[model samples]
Target: MERGRDTILLEGLRILDLTYGPSGGYAGRLFAESGAHVTKVVTGDQEISTFKDSRKRMIRTTDNQLPETIAEQLAVGHWDIVLWDSHMALHLESQLASLLEKISGSCLSVRIHFPSTVDVKEEHALQEWGGWTSLTGDPHRSPLYIGGFPATSLVGAHTAAATMFAWLEQKKGFVQVDALTVVVSALEGVYTNYLETGEVRERVGNRHHTLTPMSIFPCQNGFSFIGAPVDEQWELLERWMGRAPNPNWASVDERQQSYPALEHCIADWTQGMEREELFHTGQAFRLPFGDVQTLEDVKRCPHLNMRHFWKGQHPSDGIQLPWIIYRHSSCKLENRSHSLKRLRILDLTSMWSGPYCTRLFADHGAEVIKVEAPHRPDGIRGNSGESPAPFFNELNRNKCGITLDLRQEEERAKFLKLVATSDILIDNFSPRVMENFGLTREVLWAQQPGLIIMSLSAFGQTGPYRDYVGYGPTLESMSGLASLTGYRDGIPWLPGFSISDIGAGIHGTFALLAALYFQRRFGNGLAVDLSQYEAAIQLIGDYIIEETFSPTPLQPVGCTSIAELAIQDQRPLEVKTSDGKRSISTPWIIDNPENQTYEPAPTLGQHNPLLEDYMAKREWHHQL
Candidate 1:
């Protein structure tokens, strides 16, 4: 947790943020919030309403021409980092390119040009990330864009990360974050599966196409999720409903083929139970069960309150929002605890959030062992065939693979042995799964007291919804994101991607890192109860504030994005709603940037010896 003390992180660092849209705006915000002095130089006529002023970050509307004083200041001193949004090419070309190129660290934002065979070099080019949504959403319906999780927020996160990393390296170079590519990378596995199998993953409502018993079902109260990916769990779900498991539904293929009947049966069973009660009963039995949650419910969640997850005022809005969730006493690059490369993470997550977190870790040099069960490996891995699916490969790259059935007493003990050797353990299992195997945090902590364990679930472990089953899509709806994402006077829309999953993954990573920081600085271990739904809820802080403070009522209605709303309603003095979306592509390219590619994912159980040697070395040898 970030202390509200006078001492700040990145105290004297300065950023000249000459950017726009979500990408540039967000990148600057990251630095500003981290205690850097950020000056956002924008054209006066452009909408500044979408963005608010903060303590360390401020927006200065400016003309295209550089004022003499600023030009002299630029020539005299260097900015720690210069973020140039693609929109300011002429100014960059005529005056600022040389200045930006020489900076120690710089980030360039480009709206990805999709299917580019033709050249587009016009200024203020208007284009929406339409293809992103076109390829997302339900295949049965027309293409739709999600509200709340804007493209800029996502791209800006990546850009900020890149900039920070560059600064840590103390390197003189620029990195380009393609708005299109960031979204595409998030959607990478789908494309790889398509390219390999020629099987298009049609939007199948909210149910998973490949996994068994993965869908949102309605209960007496509202919609909830019942996700049972394996046979034993499927049997548990069935037994909870007072029914016997059908032998025909033993395999994933069988269940997937019989999905319609499966869903109907689950729906019929769940429809009779109260949503909250059903969620608890299923959780008690270790079945993945989740219910739809309102924003108010999230704010009032006992687990979050107990964890002190939300507190402190946001400088942009006076209302109390979550403090910078990823806080460390210091993040100096030289500190081993702060560097991802120095830590070893044992990954028990198969699909989205946990894998995503470790992926970021591996990208920055963390040694990750992606553990799976021999009987049931990662559900995504089997989506294609004996060979791991491309989607699985893309997400789980740079990770060593091993198999362990924690359900077995011997395997559980072996897992504990490995835990002693690891710095952190990450998993996104339904809360009860780990406990059912007797691998609870207390047990693991006994074996390794300093371990930082992150239990990532759809809901936090202690919450009423802890055992609930919901993925990225369902989370979008339950978290009020879906309600806020549609066109004005239209139905709520899915962003077509699992943003919550990705967000949880990123959030999980930062939380784990923060825990590591805590361990080093304060000699304490951390049990992080990370909820995907909670992470999604946190992203809509501004709306939560509006709902809390404004005298005017704000409901989750189908409307354009808050970026659009913040512009029209709050900053109406700047951008026109009629202007719609603009082309955000940049014509510039990285001339000579350094790059590194990762090693391939290991074969499942390829590193079984690591477990065999865990007790001896208290460390696993890496495969070169």
Candidate 2:
């Protein structure tokens, strides 16, 4: 476990560990191993627990009362980075402010939280942000929550990287992050998909919108994912089966109509072989064929093991954490030793921006410690009435978690002690939120001269809409993504997909890396103000530009022009009789084409528990 800490990534940094719950914890876990000194500060009662034999210990603090004195003490010391959940600032703004005034300078502070719809008053903070909930969902229907803690957790990583940038620049000032910005970053690819084709992707029930032979196929026991993106792979598949393309399934459209027959044919051939054989066969043909592995399968994949994607470590007692890697690099020997190497992070800015940003850091190669309040947990945790579900786990992979009642005078002291040695800090609360929490940039700079800080929110901290509330769906609607999808013949619809939130994470990683590069070169600090809603809007840049330049502006899918095109081009040309039933007939002829289809979305909470147990056992026993 100790050996892993010496990883060539973040070798010479100190991280003040103070992230409560799974989201922040996941971030801290990543930074800790890359040679960062992450001192997890917890209330004394919260003993460190390690489900496996990992070395990192969860420091349990004796003080659970509000107003963290530990945080103040840590801030007064020599630290580089600071991480915290949003509630820490909201609940302990006063106490933290006083401490911040007293601290030296140079330390970065990070805070993460969920957006709130309700207004916040002293001792009465309400959430329900605008972007996340409104932007990505159908306007007519009630907004539905997308399940994925990564959306929020990666915000933590953003906070971390942005803080590091400021530290390297020796900058001093409060910073804020926008959740919508993070969403936009992650959705760039999807947005590009639309721009390249002038087609907004609809909820096609997991079917590919344009690509053929790229869908989930049913197997004997479960499902397997397959992708034959090119014609060569398709030809290889046919050769493997020793059969030519059927006449009815020649073209893409024809294959859609004759889907049943194609499905049967493919299943007959695949069902006869073993799962390994099928996987190997696909690999042999240079096709992408992956099993729908359970969490357990993820733990045991040989490729992952060879690549060292998951770290086997016993942090304390009962928890077995398999550190997952989302970022990687092949070269790190001469370029900066550590100080965050092989660690790529994307911090999607939002109310809970810091958490989402840092989660990715933890996954790759960075010790990200998130600071949060025990009295007030992250809003997203309580939103669905399930605090730490798979949603949290998925986002917080490979990080450490802890609590800091920043309001307490004593806990503030502990926070300083931890921060004296960190790499970055991020926050998504409003501009005043940090001031209220006693985390002004001056205070952090006094503590650590080279600390980077990133502030994320709905709008930037300095913007007019900085205080807006935003969640996934709301952000979709606000970012104009929701207005782009739907049946071409009907009204524009909100995509059920949470592309905004996910895209932000990817974008955050890119931004964080750029900031990190500046830090390493200058040895100074910086403060980055990230806007989540603006970030979401960035994903649709081409659309915005085209609208400004084109004579006829593009509207949503169901606009008049699109509706006309659909009627003329896509209406079923004729009806057909199959057996005794009448069915729609495809216009084009098909000789033998792949029947690319997808199964239903996996049921919520359908992860395999037995496999989880086995993986847990492996984590407990040894480094496999």
Candidate 3:
């Protein structure tokens, strides 16, 4: 084993955050939070207000001139990453790809922008988020820009995930994340549905196409909502309301067909009760329920205080904000490099959630073995018609792919053998799929006591919706995000991105990392039950908490930005945070996983011998 190595996850990650807006700042903040040495560079006369987005985490600032030799200077500094904001600087500088190529260094240059086409005149104008969101929402209703600004945070988070992956492999290239591309990627199925089913998902007002009883209803004092996507939850809510359960609304399709009536039934019960009484009573039976919350209620939420989420004060107003959104209870710093080269993960996930989570691991230097079925491989790979799709390549990069017919008895046994040698196993199948394959938690624990199995599902392993079907829209609706997303009094609009699935992946990554650390430290097993719906609800958790106490039901306020939404009807605050601290990151070390590169996905059954050999070794070691 290596000795005396010292670092955090991103200890030597020196980043030049030259972005001018929230997206770039959000990306920088992610790296900074992960222990990167981030320098928010001020080039030309860029306004100071740009720093307000991430002022709390930023530790360094530099006054610099972007000369003709700007690329050369960046290379000379040996910065590990340069997160450049391409949208705001497009007019002032050369095209991003060219500038990045001219720079000679191993540093990863990330370009954040709005999606564009080849028409130069048209492309630059379409970079604003308002233009993009205009294409979304009800065609009848005006194109809504929620809060009237770009959704930079969504792109920024994805950029951070990609950059960390690149950094782990010593890869040098320009990574581009446009607002348009990220949003579409988030809502991948929208295009796929159009391609396969010839149906466009319309802007349905405050309800999912399938899930019944998922809308904001008027309460005694205000409006509230419930998302009983499953039969049991609906039944439970019916019992709680002292009414006969609608036997016809047992299935999602059935519920959709009679959504108006189902909604009316829920509204009838919720409208009479006090919002607080309903909130506490419904939760007692574990109903997927909540009320709408005002910003004032969000500010004073006790749940947020219990979580330590709103620990950080805003740079301008000293108002509280979330410090840590993804929480893990145990993560200790050992005297070693934060590399996952020694770890082996069995990735049995595909189509965003599971694959994305394992990609985070693979990019962090873990040896990820992605297992696909012989008859049906990853849906993304099958969808790749001709050219290499960035959609597939980006998420499945840095992992070994092998096919296994886990349904077959022989292949299933071989999988169990492989499992005994693996550190972690991850999947996003319906809760029963693993049990059906005889890969239950009890079976896994009996064979490999220390193994960590993360079963990511739409409703988790034990919920009433455990066996229910789901998609990205299912989460958006069921999680109550759709309830508060569109214009007030208008239909609840779905965002361009599959925000829920992406969040689950990111949060799942954090959960697995913590579980792995715990196993290594305490010799214990961890089972991560990641509910996509539950994970997604965290994004709008304050809204739920607020409505639980407040008299008002929060309605969709068409916001261009959170900055606008937070201020409500008041004037926007533009307080300058000029006192950001300064610190330089440590130099990169020699002992690293940079020497290793990702093994490409194997052709079907091509690597069968490798698995057979691994099983043989496992059998020999176990004296079987």
Best by lDDT: 1
Pick by TM-score: 1 or 3, better one:
1
Ranking, lDDT, top scorer first: 1, 3, 2
For each candidate, what TM-score against the reference? 0.73, 0.46, 0.61
| TM-score, cand. 2 | 0.46
* Total backbone collisions for each predicted model: 12, 219, 14
Between candidates 1 and 2, the TM-score winner: 1
RMSD of each: 9.1, 24.5, 12.0
Ranking by TM-score: 1, 3, 2
Query: Per-residue lDDT for 541-622 in model 2, tens only?
Result: 3233333222211222221121222234322222212122221111111111133111111122222232234234522111
- In model 3, the Cα lDDT at residue 97 comes to 52
What TM value does model 1 have? 0.73
Q: Candidate 3, residue 228: CA error in Å?
A: 1.5
Residue-wise C-alpha lDDT for candidate 3, range 1-624, written one tens digit per residue = 111111133555678777765556656655664456777765444443332334323323333434333454475657777777554455444644566676636668876654332122221122222223433455556554432112444556666766655554456766655454444444434432333234555455544444676656778876555667767777777787788766787776788888888788778877788876765565556664554544454445444334333424421232222222121223223332235666678999987878877865765567788898978778666444232234454566567666899899999888888787777888998877898898887787666666778888776665344565455655665555555556666444454445677767765775565444434444555577666765555455434433432221222233132222123342111111112211110011222434434433344444556676777775322110
lDDT of 1 by residue, 26-86 (tens): 5565456545677766566654423323443444545744454345545554566667655
- RMSD to native, candidate 1: 9.1
